[model samples]
Target: MTLVGRTAAIGTLDEVLAECFAGVSRTVLIEGPAGCGKSVLVDTVVERAAAAGATVLCAVASPAEQDVPLGVIRQLVHGDPSLALPEDALAAPGVPSRVQDTQSFCAALREAGRAAPVVLCVDDVRFADDASLA
Candidate 1:
């Protein structure tokens, strides 16, 4: 779908994407009432980033997944190619609440960032699992 009157928002996101590609850290939060096109805006930016060779990780959360541990993270990892995360990383359905597990996930993200610019997009984030949020 073509977005209307989002030139400024897209420009801002493009700048952030460039900064991230150049090894700088940036974050932007997009919020609005339901059906306001926040997700479409994000999807546009991330699709552009992916086309430019950035690693784009996205997850659209739902209330049904709120109780699942690391549900968002799991979705992100599973969507990545094999090399994005370690072969054994987050492979289990029921992830244990261990420090090592959390550390491993972090390590994997850091590793992926080192490989390429990483863009993480979480839509409907209010429904994201508490563990994933933490």
Candidate 2:
């Protein structure tokens, strides 16, 4: 559905985007039941990020059984090939593999943001595995 004329949440998102551009890490966790416009909020953030010259990476989880691990990372890496994986982090035994991957991906995204901001969007986080949540 189109989000035209949706001001209240979009205005708040604009404020959040301003903060992100001002060097604050934007980590907004939108929570509500279905049809509450959570995805719309995220889409607005992404649009703002893009307008501000920020790289955007987005992933959505499916309820189907064939989903893969680090699907978000795959999307981010696909969007920007310069995003690198840290070798040292992957070698650590204690780290959950996906966590290491995600962390390294985030680090790369943050570093890239130094040149131009980056926005990493992960949808259906409620379906993410506990290990991924850690």
**Top of the candidates by TM-score:** 1
Clashes of each: 0, 0
Worst 10 residues of 2 by lDDT: 65-74
Q: Point out where model 2 deviates above 4 Å.
A: 1-5, 65-67, 84-103
lDDT of each: 0.79, 0.66
Question: What's the lDDT for residue 52 in model 1?
Answer: 87
TM-score per candidate: 0.86, 0.73
Tens digits of lDDT, candidate 1, 1-134: 57899989888888988898899988889999988999899889888999989988889898988877777877877755542334444565465445565677777778888978878899999999776786
Q: What overall lDDT, based on C-alpha atoms, would model 2 receive against the true structure?
A: 0.66
Q: Kindly give the stretch of ten consecutive residues in candidate 1 with the minimal lDDT sum.
A: 81-90
Q: Which lDDT value does model 1 have at 72?
A: 84
